[model samples]
Target: MASREAPSPASRGVSANKPLPPTFKSIQDVLNGEGVAKGTLVSVIGVVRDLRRPIPTRNSGGSNHGRGPARRADQSSLTANIDWKCVMTLCDKSIDDENTAQNGATGIELHLFCPQNAMPEVGFRDVVLIKSAKVQDYRFGTSLLSNYRTAIYVYSASAIPMPPKSAKDALKPRPGSKASHVEDDEHEYVSWMYHSMNKDSLPEADVFEEQANRSLNVRDKFSLLKDVGDGGFYDLIVEVIKDPYDLLDKATVWVTDYTENKHFYHHSWDISNAESGRDGDPYGYTTAFENPTTKGWPGPYGKQCLQLTCYEPHASPLRSQVRAGGYIRLRNLQIKYGRNGGNLEGYLREDRAYPSRLGFDVIQKSEFTEDADSRLKDLLKRKLEYKKKLKQQKEAFAGLENTKAVGAKRKDNGESATKPNAKQRRKIQRAQRDQEVQKEKTQKAESLGLNKQVRCESEDQPVSSFDRILNGVSWRRTRENGEEEHLALPFTNIKFRANVRVVDFRPRRLEDFAAGRKMSEYDCLEDYDGGSASGSDGQSETLDSFAGPKTWEWRFALELEDASPKAKGEKPERIWALVDNIEAQQLVNLDAVDLQANQEQLSQLREQLFKLWGNLEECKRHEYDAHLESIRRTKLHMPPPDSSDNEIEENGPEQAGRRPPDKVSNKPFTCCLQQYGLEISEADPTKCDSGEGKRYQRVFKIFGTAVR
Candidate 1:
């Protein structure tokens, strides 16, 4: 049987009279000892698991602690006696008994009460050896405390040849027990560390390089990504579906990888000089390349869309090169969680050298690249299917519209017409002409080898400039059942022609429209009492204050009327629209920036509009005529009083209304229709329904205007 006694100091090669080198003890042994042998000194080796920042110690019963004359009022003095100590938790290599070890062994808490300057420069996972540590009964249990006499030695992984035997046991699985996947992982790690210390071992830098390259090999399909992983590089192949909408020069695009058809991805990438330094050439070229014009990736039909952010400065030039319908292979993109739910976001890895190498690579379908050809085929197939579906939808919608129109006509006419009217024939002809024009355009594009440049029809049409303003147009109406229904016009890009008389033009200061300006500056403009109406004459009133160095936007109110002869009996409508700096510049032939700096140029713009739209006098004449007609129609409805009844005027008996009150104008002002090539026409009031007031209505909120 083996001897059951610990070796004597002499046998252990230490002097018994002095002290034996503190016997190395497992954390378990120290903990189980319960400090009964409190004076005993021991050594422990552990890995620093965590570190806590040094905390200030409070003064105990000092002047600062009590309200006394000796108490220091200055904050500096109050903290003068406070000491900061850092505490850390350490994990010993010893594993609990096999049964409990599987669940993981607990780490021991170490309370380090050292001077701020004396705190150990240890980090997580650093192997540390604490020598001559005293065992004490701490607040909860036995603890090892380091004092002046204690010596701590930290070892780097490369310095340690092997971990302690007990630590190896802790990491290893018990016999006959189900082994975890990572049970032997520590052994591998130890082997690597040992090899790393050898002169013949691979360089540490090469390991990291290998790891980075290996990460690039990870290819994740869109379907597999549920939650974003730790920001790590990934590779993906996708099709660009939308043109980039720039926000602060950052390109935001929507794309589809086609792995799943139900989802779309959005990605934002920076193309500005803000990154990579304004002076640095991102593309490493002496001359910048011109980007090819492309409408955008096509197809509203496809699967999962993902948003990618390109931070590589070199990729700035690729913004225009990547077009709709283009296939691209993105590599070395870092994945991060999106602010919206579990969506994953991709960012270009700009930290690496040769960033452009990993940037978007446009895949051209060619014989040399079979995969590209296949992808192109798939894209074409999807495009065709989408177009077919769109055609079907258009047919269905047209049918529905036709049904509604026929029903309306039947209700109005009391009978459905068997033959199409001349107006209907003209409309059909116009539709055919539009179809022919579209077909011709498609053919021309194909002939010019510009298939890739062919834009969607919708994209070619102008988007409504009034979309943002019109979004606020809403009203409440009472239904037959007495329920109130809130209604708003659905936003659309449909354009209609209208003859409008410019009523008032107000120039907005550039500072007011400029971003980041104080609200107080805007408040000053809001306090202006001037109305947005033309003077009694057709001419617009010149407000010098309205045109200023800060002016950037122009707002105007217009009295509009339908140009169609069919709307001859309808009432004119009034609308307000804003013209932004860009539109204003185009109309007035002066850049807003230049105009803002020169106040004198504003009068020229105002004069030009006055010439085009006529003066307030002309507008007022048209309005007065319309108002008189309205009053005359109202008077006709009044029944003549019977001769037997005495007539008493509301004004008073003294003035029995010297004459029947002439037609009183209910409208405050009238607008000129001649400027819009329109003339007021008389119509039989009996032939028109009261509800037709909305027929000639046309309203717009212009954004930018130039005012003198």
Candidate 2:
């Protein structure tokens, strides 16, 4: 048996107010004693993995797995390979969750046994709880702690002495019951006690070096205590230090800047009120990190890390197969640091789990090596590029913001700028387009009869009246199903006429307007007071001489007032704002002549293209047009071929009708017709009726336009 020996806080680089208990003690007498025997309480830290007891798989309207029938199966399967050893490893994990462990048939009863003289004197058995990390497969639970192994420790008892009775039982003769001790009487009893309490012999520094390796073997950070004499390292098992810091979890790993030391001990190793030999350290051992020359080692700086242990279940009463949800693996583990008892402060070294048991190859790898400056430079460059991209995005967003704000201001200044307050107008126009898109998405989804419920989000923006005012558009409100007010064209006044003759003309009916006019008819250009036609005459006009556009004398006479006017002797500003659901007066009426004229220009222009592209956009736009014109010109420039002249010679006399309405070749006609869907007839001898040929003529008429 071993007894704990720890230096006082003053000796260690810490200020521990409470005395640390011994780390090791014997459990023999307690096993036989009548009183409550204290078992070492292990500090188990990990995420919670659900306890599963495998039941028959029952299909509940999910996916079908097995072949044969569409019928359901028993879906109550415990999907995971549980490690039964972990369950058996603990002597008894207290029933923290009564509902989960006590009555639940699925949850297990934990079994635990600890080193007697542990940090808490003797760990509290009833209060202890062991949780397995959910994802124990190749990740968190199993992989995270795979390289690690548990270390059992033994020491003589002092405060709570053993009963001294169980020791005599092993030597007792079997009462008609077969009994043969594993070893000699006293020695066998003590040895058996140790064996029963712990499975393997205590680990040593040099022995650990021989055994521990990265790939072949792993060292458990939880192994035995380390010595201190080797430059505050090799005295007794461990040294106690006081710091409020605590926990080595992912979120806390990078709490502070990384230190030079790698391998570190946990704070739980501290034994309150413990004392050892004159060396003062509870225990001591050398890590594989010893330097050949100085016997001291250096560690990585700023490389933060933590011990993340995940437990896997080999077999559980609940989970016999593997499941994705069976275990949850923790990520981003780090050592905690800071004023609040952080995990970083408790560690003596990191990297190798059990630094004391390090081997040769591991030590070689553990030694600090030259940093690849080039890689670091590359990393820095990548980080910089990422930051630059983020900044560019932010700047673009800012530009958009400014544009939006400028547009709003421009819209508000309705009568000032002749630019049509286009920015605000476009913004409002986009809202309509957005609404259309949302409607289409919804309708398509509904048509498919699938539940793709998407909410149409209307922009929460201030409405702008730019289109209604400067664009000279009108609105008529009709109550549709008495729910929404629909705005249509024709007239409805939001701003009452009070000298509303600022417009060119005002007409009540659509037919009352004349031809070739947009809003000119609705505008009132004649001045009521000044008998001037209010029309722009050929003569130059001065501001004072002109009394603005004539006023519309409405039946409802209202005093006119300017909402906002420029300072005296300054140009008046334009203003615009959006009204949500109000009837508006329309200026332009829809007409076929206007639509036809607009379409004609577009149709004619469609036949044209600029061979000299001004920019990337124009190059894309004019590519086809340019190609057609070039082909026609090339054909015209070609010399007449002798073979093709046979057609004219066979005709004998020149026949006017034989021209065949400027007939084009079948190949060219087919190409043109196929491309533009135009059909050519032989009726007219000089012209083609198919709109495409006419457009091709127009393209030829224009220098920069296409021919085909």
Which numbered prediction scores highest in lDDT against the true structure? 1
- Per-candidate Cα lDDT values, in order, are 0.41, 0.24
What tens digits encode model 2's per-residue C-alpha lDDT throughout 482-572?
A: 5545333222233211001011111322122222322221122121121222231234656644353322211111111112212367543
Candidate 1 is scored at a TM of 0.22
Q: Write down the worst ten-residue block by lDDT for model 2.
A: 666-675
Separate clash counts for every candidate: 42, 105
Can you write out model 1's per-residue Cα lDDT over 483-585, one digit (the tens) per residue? 9887553332334322233443332322222122111111123222222211221355356534433333433334332221122465544455445434444
**lDDT value for model 2:** 0.24
